[model samples]
Target: MESLRELFKIGFGPSSSHTMGPQRAASKIKEQYPNASRFEVELYGSLALTGKGHLTDYIIKQTLGKQTIVRFKSDRLPYHPNGMKFYVYQDEEILDTITAYSIGGGTVEYEGSKLQQTKQIYPHKNLKEIIQYIEDNGISFYDYVLNYEDEHFKAYLFEVLDSMFTCVQNGLHHEGVIPGRLQLKRVAKSMYQQAINTRRESDRERLLVSSYAYAVSEENACGNKIVTAPTCGASGILPAVLFYCYKQLEIPRKELIKALAVAGLFGNVIKHNATISGADGGCQAEVGSACAMAAAAYGWILELNNSLIEYAAEMGLEHNLGLTCDPVGGYVQIPCIERNGFGALRAIDAASYAKQLGYLRKNKVSFDSIVNVMKETGKDLNSAYKETSLGGLAKEFGLKDGD
Candidate 1:
């Protein structure tokens, strides 16, 4: 099976499945049809329904303009009046009259009578079909689609892992100390200060302790917050693991990439077999899956057996069972940011405990079984918690009501 690097990626904020995914698909479209003078874009299903709230439209626009999605500045985003349109580049002049949509989970499609529909084995609502009309008598169908669940190639995996490490480090240092929003109760600056004070300790120990301290403060100040995983809305978890590996274990930079690779593999498996988008599977899919990935990575870096890695991964997933994607506001602000810290702490705990318990003797949990449960649970969840901004904290707190 291919590794996880291809499945999970590091990109701009707000969303992975929503913003990043669509941009990725757009790049793929360009890749398959380079040198084309004109191109059109379209969207379908869930992407159309709640794309605006998730910033899917903006992502697609940037993608089709041949801009690099990962590094593009927020102010440079392209804007279009309609959801679909075309771009014509001739004589070094760039003219875009294209139409597109931001399907939830980062999916976008181009619309037209000439469009050719391409189907995938995976069942997802946010589908994109890019059709080009060639002069040849025979018509050709091109599918610039992304499959979240399938195993990805090694080269792709490495690229993503490398990007993720860079993103996290850049976000932490250059992003200028993530502002504390989301009623998180704890403050990023405060936590950072505490982490600094504990600099005498190993990175792993300092990160673990500081995170626990922050979680304690948050619980005391406000209440429980979900982990945002790779995002600030889902932050903390990935950073915690990365910091621990870098500081405590003193893992080399090259080995860190390997660790991330292992982590990405675990995340991709959950995404493929279950869900990673909050719109589809709730917070469990997002944060829970991230925790599971971190745990597996920790185990792998520690040189544990495959069984240990599996155990850590399963523990990470199971512990976060039934989490809901209930951000107070539609923005990835609010509870989303602080939640990452909690998830990261949990991952470390799970990894350490799994090591102590002995993977050889620990009860085995089937990945397939857990995935099935996640899918069933997501189906049973209310629409309010599924990225609709209608339930959970979004509605209960009256944040962005009528928005």
Candidate 2:
């Protein structure tokens, strides 16, 4: 039941769990050993498997200095899949050693006392508790968050929304191959231009939204500063949907901010009950959570009732269950970039469907239950499918190094 700090992290990232987390950890370790002669960082599990492509070493080097040594440990950690060990050396003597885990959604946990960093702002953690509170108090989730979280959180959210918009703008204009072996061309500009020139009205919204999602996600892939809707890998979904809501649906800026609050609440529930890391729960945790967060926000913007909002959120994750995190060549391009467009589309569809089915009690599944199932399913998945790029499309494509 930690605060929703992970919901909207503004950082440069090709991968949050891989790049941002390690850089953050390195910065922390640097603070502890400012005068150390040298530093070495060991990346474990998924972080190591994809560190080269995700620029984990590059970011760590930037934080610790050019001479910083980075070693990749393919062996999985007992604590979390994305683990890093930082060491400081002076005159051939070990000054300090630190270990940390990037537990999805840009959250880093130190070797010990990780729990000490978390604070529960809301008394309620799960959907059921919040639902009960809503039923009793007759106030919406929006009200609940406003009542519980202080003004600072709201101000932070405004900044987050502004940053999201700025990211989309930056992505749309930037073109050329992202720095990597794949040499993938930026598509947001072309997509946006194509959408604008579309002769058919039916495809306008879809095209534009996909372009927006592509913009943010492609920016993430290039290690540009972007907000992690849940995480950087799936950052595009929420922004795409929100932008569409603002431009197409004409939702006001004030209402859109409120919608963001509701979305953060939904994401916080999943982060508490399940997770939001591809390394932990495959792509289902990352993209699925983003899809659900977007759907919930859309539902709230539509003024749908609480049950319908939950239903929208649940469908988003349910439909994406078991989706593997198999980034091609360990880079967050390929399936990852296109995946954000699909996730955003699914989120929009899920929200519309939930709104259409409002008050119909024919559902057999619940949002809270789906969160549990997602975590269990993630735990049951093979390591290769969980962001190691060893299985699924990552393997079958036979482009291990994209060589």
Candidate 3:
């Protein structure tokens, strides 16, 4: 794992892989050819298929300006699912041609660059192995993260948490129809208002979390700034759960910071062991991972022991296994925004269930095992189901290739 920084990227959303990643790639091009007269980029596979709705082209143009030429290459690349080739020209002649892959989140890999070393922050890469180390060290999982992370990590996490809440506040205040053909009415503000007025005490926490999740997801869909708890596609889950716990359960800010650390560690584990990009692993890797992260965080907040905390995280991912990346209309709207609400609700419920069951004591399955299974299942999934928008809800809604 690189750092919690890699796991939580603060950027313009809707789609992290499609928007943030491409913007980063274009930024590198601008730096390399500062005086170039022309720039061209050909988006491939998942990028090409859903780039329009994700604002991939708009982002690139915004980064590189009007001199840029863009193309949609629908054919899948051999290197990665979300691939783009960049061409820079000093005049009419091509100066350089480079290809890059937006692996996941906001990370990008250049074809000619040396491969990124999978640096191990801790000795263990999975939850099963780390739990034993935790048992021996007399330390919590968050302590394990602290042992390896920089001393300034506390400040970094504070910033991340700050950004999360800011997005929620902004999303809650903004009310209008979201962009794109769907004209999806902004429901977060209304949802929040309803939750506030509800007399059903049992529904208060659930509704609050659901509204918060919707707020964050709606912000992302509107191209507003938000933190990618794992990725922009699933940005809403962690904040919704954590904020709910802080407000409803009255957890202290310092304790919530520890919870954030725990969640980041879990996210890093998944990103290292499998994939977090829908272009590679579908929605299972994106929102599914976010749910697990939120679950573990909430479990920590609830004062669950290590075993149950892991169990909560396990249930979060297990139930969401094989969830496909089926954002309707290629826009991270319809199912994507609604999906975050469900992810938040499930995460909170999973934590409570694990605590009640004492799942760590008798559960047969392990979080590490599920991580492996998720990767295998993602590999087995068809390309169309992995953010290409060529199948599932996209196809059912009559969205064609490159739509």
Give the alpha-carbon lDDT of every model: 0.53, 0.88, 0.88
RMSD, every candidate, angstroms: 11.6, 1.7, 1.9
lDDT of 2 by residue, 1-403 (tens): 6666656789987888888888777887777778899998888999888888888888899999976999988697799999888777996999777788999877888876332355677888799999999889988887888887777887888888888989999999999998777788999999999999999987988999999999999899988999988999999999999988888888887889889988989999998889898989999999999999999998998788888999999999999999999988889997999999999999989989998876666567889999999999999999889988898888987766334
Residues 291-318, candidate 1, lDDT per residue (tens digit)? 8878877887777766566777788888
- Off-target runs (Cα >4 Å) in candidate 3 are 114-123, 359-361, 400-403
After TM-score superposition, the amount by which residue 253's alpha carbon in candidate 1 deviates from its true location, in angstroms, is 2.3
Better of 1 and 2 by TM-score: 2
Candidates sorted on TM-score, descending: 2, 3, 1
Better of 1 and 3 by TM-score: 3
Q: How do the predictions measure up, each by TM-score?
A: 0.65, 0.96, 0.95
How far in Å is the alpha carbon of 74 misplaced in model 1?
27
Q: Is candidate 1 or candidate 3 better by lDDT?
A: 3
Q: In candidate 3, how many clashes are counted?
A: 0
Tell me the number of clashing residue pairs for each predicted model.
40, 0, 0
